[model samples]
Target: MVAIIKTGHSIRAMLNYNENKIKQGKAECIGQGNFPVDADRLTYIMKLNRLEKQCKLNENVKRNTVHISLNFDPSEASLPKEKLLEIAGSYMEKIGFGDQPYLIYKHNDAGHPHIHITTINVQENGKRIVMHNIGKDKSEPARKEIEQAFNLVKAEHQKKKEFKPEPVSVRVQYGKTETKNAIENGLNFVVNNYKFTSLPELNAVLKLYNIEADKGNENSRVAKHSGLLYHALNGKGTRVGVPIKASRFHDKPTLKKLEKKFVANEIKRQTDKSRIKNAIDNVLLRNNIIILPQLVKQLKKEGIDTVLRQNAKGLVYGATFVDHKTKSVFNGSGIGKEYSAKELRDKCGANLEKLKGEFQKAYSRDDLLNMIKEDRGLLSIDDITKIVDLLSKTESTFDYLNKDFLKQRRRKRHRRGN
Candidate 1:
């Protein structure tokens, strides 16, 4: 999970802050925090409006408004409300809220879970919170701390199966078409992964590279493409915008270089998914460990004792024990016989989970049913129906429910009654 922190006026404004910057690292206000580490960062974003509202920064300024904004993503262990309060309290303890105070506002207006802390530069104690390195000084350490805390929450949420997973597809909008397409395709192609964020910074880098960025409709001279844009970091650590024009720019050394660098990351992600799949399989196989407790008797009667363990393969696993001494092992006959429970979970169950989620989110049942029925070289209708039925019985069915079927069922019931 990505944790981003920045400051803005009226907690609402911070909540409403652009989501694009949080994901893509586009509209960034660097701060005093360590880079790429799990930590909380703080920034004193001089609000253009607040500054104009309060004529303190300049005579042309009109009124008293928010002078600084600090934002960060706290771990799920620390709820947004709690994190916001902690940030506000920490600042209050250090210097006390200024005449024009800062509030830690919980923002959900954007995609990623984030918060905003807006305050005046002047503290009540006559101490001033200075904006150093364009607020990089304050943002760095704060971001580190925030990441650390947020990571803990993420871990806990993962265990509880309640983690707010990110969207598979996220949209990124840019003020300029050149910048937008550059970002969309560049990041996707260069990174071989799709995520939203980084338009402004990408544009900034393109400007340096003399990439001729303009917002218009023109297919000539490399107009639109698919993939991702990566900031090509030179040996000197300066970012150069590198656009990966799919199919067209595949031969570029820069693209090849990034592919090599991120291949390891892709492998790691695949490995992690594989591991989680095995773990979930183990949980399911431990049928004796029933959530209702009553199922334990049924499992025992069937001469099945489910025992779960973390396999040497770095995945959770389990096996059926007929007696205290009799342990079930793979006979290498049918499915799941050759591979351990973890292997099966990762290979089939995990993917099923993702598919089921998408299946549930499917807009129309006919479309989904048709996809399933058609197989479409993916899954059989029978299998899809089974998953859908299973989802209906689950508690958090919102993400899995067949909304079209439910809607139709309601209509049919109403018609029958009429």
Candidate 2:
């Protein structure tokens, strides 16, 4: 089994996430630990009140929430819910949370069978639990002991299994899933996982999953009241479904809450900014000139996604980079001047005339046609169109020049200038 533990300040958010999954038919509340009522009999208010009441005991403990997921190998998908609850109960007892009130949820969304446990770290005596390195010092040993005691597949052995679990949150497909549930899933994943400093940065990450958080126009009543709405976007990036008010979600991802997140994320995402800048620099260094589309493609290969913002007139006005590796989002101007939309567009356009000259000198019409035939599978639609246009008019050539040859020529020109 693989165990993952996370601590947060909001017990409501953790509960809402799992409960929302239940509403979507992707998970179920199997059991509750240290609670008076059974899991099936408990209401949402009962769950939240229990955790919040304990959390209120110690106002000083900010990170009082504990959310844990116990993941099993795909081979154990048939594990009975009762057996899963038993394992969860034993795991909690071994880790010192046996007496704490925790709600256990068995989620069916991933390939592997897993259960999420939500609890608070505060005791009834208004004292905080020592959670420092709790996973390494307590959970790891408990996991090993449980694996041996239950005769289950060991964590080390499960690593060699061919099956890999899919992500819990996937891109929202229009009309495929419930609108509120899909948006909530995207919001839960992005809000918890990614460090985005502003609304646009958050939207950049959310856009990957076809979700957006919108605050109405400046003079609108919603904006005046600091209201926020989440909408599902179609394939064309236009909002299609009814916009759900932020307050409608259990977690209450309101403008006020997001402002607090923006402040925290600004500090958290700082160390990661340099890594994104370096990735962009590396891509720029490899080519004399690169359009936004090519730059976006190359960055994706490095596990970074670029979202370019454009106006109604189709002018590139901004750029935001979402680095999946680091879980960080950075606006172009936030990184440096060179990475800004205007500067990048200028750099891409600077050598276009020179690039066309190089292409013409490098390949003839017959050579271009043969090259296209040979690399058709490797070429993008834009590349094919450029090559076709070049064949029709000798004066117009594509930007498909040899990069190595261009680099060599650049060096020679530099030497001559010196």
Candidate maximizing TM-score:
2
Q: What does candidate 2's lDDT look like per residue over 1-418, in tens digits?
A: 9888878888878888899789889999999998889999999999999999988989999989998999888788998988888899999999999989999999987556889999999999998889999889999999999998877899888842223322213354444445566676568668877898888999998888777889988997778878798878776677875678887775678788888989999999899999999998999888765555667779999989988876654457788999987889999999998889889866655543344556676457786687477644334455556667657776444345578987999999999999
Cα lDDT of model 1 by residue, 301-398, tens digit: 44333333334442334322222112121111111353443443344444454544454443245544453444322333334555566555455555
Q: What value of lDDT does candidate 2 attain over all alpha carbons?
A: 0.80
RMSD (Cα, Å) for all candidates, in order, is: 19.4, 9.0
Which regions of candidate 2 deviate over 4 angstroms? 1-24, 35-76, 110-112, 119-177, 219-221, 361-392, 395-418
> Once superposed on the true structure, which residue ranges of model 1 sit more than 4 Å away at CA?
1-54, 57-83, 91-100, 109-112, 120-129, 134-137, 142-213, 217-418
| All candidates: TM-score | 0.26, 0.70
Best by lDDT: 2
Worst 10 residues of 2 by lDDT: 160-169
